[model samples]
Target chain A: MDNPNLEDLLIACRQGSDDAFRKLFEQYHMRVMSTAYRMCGNIQEAEDVTQDVFLKAFKEIKKFREAASLFTWLYRITINLCIDKERKRQRRQKYHENVDVDSERITIEEANSNENTRTLDQQMWQDEIQSILQKALSRIKPKFRTVLVLKDIEGLSYEEAAQAVGCSQGTISSRLNRGRKELKTLLVKMGMGEEYFQER
Target chain B: MKHGFTQKNLSAYLDAELSPDKVQKIELHLQSCESCLRELQEIRSGKAVATCFENPDWQDTEALWQNIQRLNISTPEKGDVKNLEMKRTNLWQRLIHPRPAFAIAVLLILFGINLFSNLKQKKFQYQRVQLDQELSYGFDYGLYLDALVAGSPAIEFERRYESQQASYEQARSQTTFRLASFTHMPKTFQLREVRLLKNACCRSVQFSCLENSREVIIFQQPQGHPVTFGNYPLERIELNGQMYHRIKTGKWTVLSLQLKESQFMAIGEMNESDIAAIIFAITTI
Candidate 1:
């Protein structure tokens, strides 16, 4: 999977070597899908973003220089594309097709059923914590959500998050703060304060 | 500090982004203030929950997608309509306004392109045979083999030749070749084409060989010396069981050699059969 020649293969691809380009695409296709899926938080949207990123990358790869590693370049592109899609998503009201009902209720039911074999306290608390977190995450704006994902989830630094979204570090720093604060507010509302928010 | 901090500033403090002075101030304030500290803890927990989404089982689809790329197959089976129509695209329109026809067309073109490229032999043949027919070209080859490995030059004349990128309508281009000999060969170095300035900088003589589908590129960069890509001389040497030509002076390596029509560079190392097959492929083309 870690073929050092992947970059060289990409160069050949940009040079119109169809064979080389195919190899490059195959090597990174799933990783790109994984990243997109994680960022978008939905299977279909993830698939769509993955398809879009690769298509866009294929078109613009000729302009890609060795200024950045190929994975970094692709990572930056995927995040940007997803962020763009997300902003647009916010403008239009979004509804989850499958999980349209109260997510917390569904999670509680699922948790209760799954934890039947276990003692009730541990199972109940786990379900309660998860539902609280999920509901809270759904309330934040996409910008903050993106920063949260990249930083906490993807573990990117402020500068890297900024570069991915085409913003200044100051913006990322601020947005991340805003996101964390919102999460805290939501968590406090859910009464999961001590379990999850004790150290925030 | 009166408001304690903005939501963002407090969050940043939790993330440890504040400098020493700022960090100290935030810590002092948060230590005394239970409300903000509680908010901070909540935010951190929420942030941790979000990590669950970070690394999902995207790996399951990895194989499926890799196969897609390997097969170079676009399932939608639609011709590219965007490039066909020549629609406009930029951040502004792409963001607020997406051209479905244009976007889909662009997507279609891209998908088609990928489908063609990834269709290596292992995957489904798909439409590759048809696409390959469109892209494939005839080959005519030249052998500096006669002169590829010979002597070394001290004073070298290097040249970066002209290059052209082909378009969809024009996938194939004729290759050009030239050869010249010098009094001495440089020890071992490749002439770089990547950093050359606009002008051809060598004292070049004008000459042309019979036109063919092969290009034998020998270029060099001499410290404190000027070289040109025109008709400069070349030399050859056999080093470590492989033959390389040093054309026209010091520190030149074979930049690249192309064989046309169903042929490939043995890449960095080649045996006799590979070399002969390369020649055969070019000749057959």
Candidate 2:
């Protein structure tokens, strides 16, 4: 949609119009849900975070200044919520450390069985690669992980990433560098061959 | 060229975040640097791996929106759009143009300090008035005597005796020291009232005499008791082998003398000679 049209839609949403809100959700829900999924490493949590983001955006639509684009604002909220969810997950992991080991082993076995049943195809291979990437991404710290997700995965420019992260462009550049190095090291350590990353 | 490029520079160059000149310099350095090129390739591979993780299609957009709408229904609305827009504009203006906001914050802080100091001063004044009232009613004898001799309004006595003999008897009964009485009286001055006074500092008997419109008071207390009253300078004089300390305050004269076991003070608007004569005529008998 054009800028003026988006502005009008935002105004309508601010006026407590449910139709405008639904239109906004239709327009950006994919991107929001996708980013949430990458950040959370799970579809369920991504859906939950996406719902929370839209609800918060709807409620705070009035406070939305025109200084930033709507997408940037939504992304900022998504990143914050994702980080909060990550922290809670970490706390839960610590609480159920012993219980989590068995569950994690079962999940890995199930994933192997599912993969064995799938026909060897490009789509399945891509999905497997995506899953492995997500696991590595989740292993990295949230600060660097967010930068990588925004810059590499989501393809946001450094300026846009800086705005979404509420930081300077220099900080974004620095974090992106570290995040790339850490992700590369983690992928190599995960025994993913260098050929997997070779351009198809 | 020797160091090629730092990881940060290479990363920023890959993202096209660096300035054109820096990007040109790094590009030139990369041509001659094999290790940096290898590192750059590794970073590219990482980026490629990350980019391969495309956004999984979310099929539950409608369900999620419904859930969001349901949640939004329960949450209270902040305000109408127009009011919120105005507030947002004001907030943005404050952020974008901070000088006015800073000036207003300073003014508010100054106003708060002024208000606090005024309240503190008022509280201090109130406490001082309360303390003065308590001291007066508590019969601070020194302050009362000072006020009387200075011709200011003295604190009221707790009890007044109808007759001089009755007051003298009460004074003698209440005190351990020998009480002195007037043997001879001045013809012009007639006794008016007598009061017994006591406080934390000391206890004394007060005799009030009236000479027409003017008044005189005599106080008798135990010798060596502490006095907490005026800051007046004293003059000493010997009359009939009795040493008297005299102080003049405003129009009133105070004459004090130590007898055998008691201290007697006469306060009145009288000449020095008359007060001295009154003191000499008083005896323990």
Candidate 3:
């Protein structure tokens, strides 16, 4: 949504209009949900991040500066939550690895459960390729993955993505290059073959 | 174009984030250098591959909207109410869980203040007794009257009398009074008892009558008792060549008469007409 209408909605929301809030939720929930899914790699976590972002946005709407677009603010919140969730998961995993003797079995069981969820036919080329890409994407560092997801996957312009990620356009450019190279190397390692990256 | 452009520029060129001039320079370089062209193709393909992470289906949107609604509803508006709530909560928290040193200091300060006030009140009680004796016309009656009224000694006396009514009753029964002095009281006012003031020299007789449950007190001070009724706006009325002083203090109007040995002061909530009648009746005795 355009800033003027969004600014109007924000003003109305600040003036305590439930209708304006509902309109804002309707307008941004999809994009916020999509960006969260791209960043977190799961529908459930993405929904949680989406809800958190909008709830945060609603609570802090009075603090929202007109200089920044509403989506950029929402994107920043969603990104932070995703990063926090990822860090907490990593910490828990590290702790479990240290204390839990059956950590290896637990990891295998988690993998099996994840595999079980993707019961989509492997014969479908798009689903199979996309599933492999999702796994490779999750394997990359979050800093690079975020830049790549915002720029390449979510299709935000470099300037918009920079604003969303709280970085300069030049940094977005550099990170996109590093992220693309890492993803390409990961895909090749996963037997997608070099030819998969050669075509435009 | 000098080194076939860097990978950062190549990525920017693919993203169309670079300036048009930079884009043209990179495109021309890509055309001249087959390796640069192949690398651009690789970056483009990789970018496309990354786009394969499709957005999952949105779920629980109603629940999320409800949550957002709840958040908005629960948020206090930007006003004094929100600040007041935060301040109230902070005050409540501090009050309940005060720091040990702070709580101790507060308790000590409060105890000191209470102790100091109690000591001052005890001093005032003693001073009040001195001021009451000085209320009789002797030296600087205005200053002593102002001090008495300002300190409100009457309220203190009332408080003491209420607390020690039985003690006052015992003192009243033990006290002796002249039977002829009893004639100074009016017929409507029944003489309850004669009680001694704290100063053993001063005595007061209490009288009660069923005139709207009113009671009168007559202070009968001994002869030449250094006490005078001179401070009040007294009207000198010579009844049958003997002088009487009529005065009003707050709700009670007093009729005072000086005899050869003692001063008699009668005080009651009696009206002007009733006061004249009582004065006339008391003086005739």
Candidate 4:
């Protein structure tokens, strides 16, 4: 939707229009859900995060003030919810060893299995690369992972990422550099070594 | 040549985040250094691989939208907007333009007086069915509650106590949560007034109820405040899987429970059982 249409929808939403809210949700749910999914690496947690972000957005839309784009505001809420869910999951997992690696592998396979656009071989290779990348991304600290995901995966500019993450542009630059370097090391270790770099 | 540019600088260069001078230097160095060039290329490839995993666009939009709609979330209704605006402009106009606006002010005050009297009559009828006693409580209840709330750090209870009062319907309209989330109330005890007090320290929503001559006050604050309600004995109890603190001081019983992110406190001149029953009704619903 165009900017004017979004603004009109937002105003209607602020004035308590459920239809307007549903429209807004339709417009941004994909981006919000994907960000949450990528951040937490779990489909269930991502769904919960999306529900919370929209619920909160709908409740507090009047106070939104439009200081940032609606999507940026929504993304910030998604990131926060993902972090909170991760922390809660960690606490609940104090006694149990992590089984996410195998579970995530299955989830990724199941996710790709449904799509017919890619050839079987291509799908398998893509799933492998994605699973490895997600595992590596999960290993990185939340601060760095957040910046890297916003910048590279979400395709947010430095300024937009900074606003979404509630940090300065300088902080985003520094975190991106550190995050990219860490990711590079992890990818190399996952058998995507010098040859893979040359191929890309 | 100076030592090779650091990895962070190279990353910055790759992202185009560097100043022109630094960019020029980094480009000059990269032209001659195959090693650095390879590293940059590797970083780019890593970013590409990381960004490649697109979870198929969320296919369950209808299901999710249904879930959201079930929340009963909505902005303030038109009537609520009119009332809120009336309240704000009434106060400011009276203070700023009292003399020349006398005629209109008088008419408004007279209208308000008529409305309030009618509300009082309705309340009396409701309270007669609910409470046998006279409305024995006064602003002292407000003071006691304020004292209890004042124990929390950062709230200006004295200032808030006066400004927070509003009609029950107004409070219902403005509550942060849906009124249903607040749960059921005893039929005899009609909501007389509601107040929302907030500052940098805490946010509180107070609901005042009247039964005959007795008054009940309910307030909610975010959890984690160090709150004390005098030297009264506090008995910890659990009901409906929720924990509560029951404080009995002579004729007054106060029930405090923490739900989600908010701690709710209900106080009145009643027994522990009555207060507990009210707490249960409010919390579980």
Candidate 5:
């Protein structure tokens, strides 16, 4: 919001400047992709959500008021779209459980094979840790997960997270509290000891 | 300093979101209260762990932008925007300059419709209550089991099995139907708790499993006594000559399948892959 170049780009985007839109996408796509990835817990789904978010922002660029920053607006869209995607995935799962059963089985087998092929080196260890953390995060309730992703992972301020989630700061604080506790319990259960999280 | 800081306060403290005065008070309290200090450490550790989650590399910006542009081929023309603005203005003008007679007529019609709909709704409610009373042992029973798994305080019953084996043994002794034991489970899940569900007409045993931190409940009842989830559209799938029914309620997925004389319902917020794996584990076992 404070960037004059961003403001000019926004103006140009509103005036149907594709170049300006491209610039804006390049600036914020990584942020959006990261947020979506953490929220969805799957890289493919995150990519899909990122695409949808940009498409939605482009389509509704004319209606974007300057009351909120472009980042916050795009974030709100990303969260809403991620949530929608989650719901649709749940619904789709109900019907296509068997149809994709074999593919999922193969994915699990491939993951196991990949783990075996990769040496237990530092990078593999890091990837394992990241995978465990993601699994724990995916187990959390969506409301709590979103807050954690936006505030903790994405490094959004309390005010910014509240604006993006369309909630009061108090709600965000409470959700963050619960989310952190749940994540800790999950991490501990997933073999990440409490001491691992503690500072040296 | 009468009590330790609330979780919200401690959480905010970790994020440096507290006011100067509040931060000073918490710091003062943290020195004296080991319990509060530990809680603060745990919260900080949790935040640190969360911060360690790095964003994955996403190098598809150009491709994604191009896809967006391709999908947005029908961009609104300048004339279209002007027409939309004109229409919005006209709508505002009409709202500002309403005819009193037309407004009164429309209000009267709306009032009449509201009255008629209210009457109809009352009749429908009466019938629904009657239907619910009849299906209380069926539809409401499933919800009661769900509530129990969710740990709803509204339930007056306080019966829980001491262990999984005890639960299975008790259920086997009490019910005439065959109890299906999950000899095999998905690798990611572990059996956590078990509870017995009993009412006037039917009996069931609820097995709760923990997949990571999420709770998955599997309910087993006699085949003839089906747990009906009222008004929720269920998707039916046929696999290996057995029919399975599934439905999504919010984030939770309810999947029920019949095996011989036992009816099994598994409810959890699991992906399709996990659900399929669970189904395979159950069916194969």
Candidate 6:
């Protein structure tokens, strides 16, 4: 019974108790790393982000309260950090985007081309039915994408998902519904809708 | 049940949260709609698969719990050790070589400030007169940064060209519901002032087309390189009736705007975040 849940670990970390912080980190490290990995597209960036999140959590653990779960607080920090990292990366890519005058790399032609399709199929779609699912996943806006990842992909309940993404339950439900619809449409577009999955 | 139910209704039905009538309707809708049926199946499959991943040996993550030992780990600033080493060497030398070295360091710091202010004045002064006329106002950096850092005066604004303007006391306040229409300048920029210059006189907004934008200029002074886009003079556009325009004038780019309502000049020399608060204070007069 004493095996600390998220709340316990947060309380422990707050008291400057290393054991409590360690327990919380241990329980959530993989989840946090995996979450970051999925949120961003790279494993290395996720690992770095994991370390940064822990370091920040350690420093700011004093601010942790019972209002939200420890994991939710961790997620807010992680998402913010990852977004910031993406912005910095864009700063580095300024030279590249600046050179291209015609398009921002996503031209209608490029979007429909076989090369991009193959790339999308190969990269986003890992297995057979998974590809169509991925196209659907890709169609969701960034705001909704995080919600789906947390809820369906990560299997967090509605409340946990809301706290993690910093939104209300109603918002989470709406986003999840909209995301589900978009994902379904994406699957249909990929020609792997009901007919394809009907066999499975 | 033509459009039987949304994915939301399906899930609610599955979760048993839907009313009986809603469930009956959804069930009828699902019976006929092939697409919704497929999506429901796919979600069930994904959910089952997602469950199999049951936190994957999070129990054995005990090894990672060792990182918790680092909770007490004194996080050091990246520069601390190097600075310490430099200080150690300086301390040893202080014991050996004393007076002139200390005097020289002080002299260097004073000289550094003088050199910095001189360069700042010279660089800004060179552009001041042309900028002043173009901006339709006198140039004063100190007065401007302070007004932005505190808050802009609660002035009544009456702009002939402004379609809309939203002002906030602090930059962070601007990011809430007010700017949901468009992205506000990030609060990290630490804004010093927010002023909406008239299209008749405010400096050119290089990359924005938002007519009559709530311009949030950060108060960060410039460091390192100045923005240089070759010889292209900035292009200014007065937004149409109610669109917003975002413009940045950092040390590298000096944007001076002359408008009918007010003389609006954006002097860029600092990082964007340092002046975010001031930028948020901007409102239509």
lDDT of 6 by residue, B1-285 (tens): 756345655544544556688778888888888998876776554344332222222234353344433332533532132333344365767665768778888999999998997666432111111122332233334333322322322221112112333222222222221111212333333223333332323221111112222332322222321233233345544333322223333323334333334333344333434333323233221
For each candidate, what is the lDDT?
A: 0.49, 0.67, 0.62, 0.63, 0.67, 0.49
Any runs in candidate 4 off by more than 4 Å, and if so which?
Answer: A94-121, A193-200, B1-9, B28-42, B73-285
Write down the TM-score of model 1's second chain: 0.23
DockQ preference between candidates 1 and 3, better one: 3
Against the true chain A, what TM-score does chain A of candidate 2 give?
0.84
Candidate 5 clash pair list: none
Query: Can you give the lDDT of residue B171 in candidate 1?
Result: 20
In order, the first chain's TM-score in every candidate is: 0.68, 0.84, 0.80, 0.82, 0.84, 0.67
Top candidate, metric TM-score: 2
Assess each model's interface with DockQ, reporting 2 decimals per model. 0.19, 0.31, 0.26, 0.15, 0.20, 0.07
Residue A72 CA displacement from its true place in model 3, Å: 1.7
Identify the runs in model 1 with alpha carbons over 4 angstroms from their true place: A1-10, A17-31, A69-72, A83-103, A106-139, A184-200, B1-7, B32-35, B52-54, B59-285
Q: Model 1 Cα displacement at B34 (Å)? A: 4.6
lDDT of 2 at B260: 80
lDDT of 1: 0.49
Model 5: DockQ score: 0.20
Better of 3 and 5 by DockQ: 3
Residue runs of model 5 more than 4 Å from their true location after superposition: A94-120, B1-5, B31-35, B74-285
Quote model 4's TM-score: 0.49
lDDT of 3 at B267: 57
Model 1 C-alpha lDDT per residue in residues A78-100, reported as the tens digit of each score: 87777777778868966553343
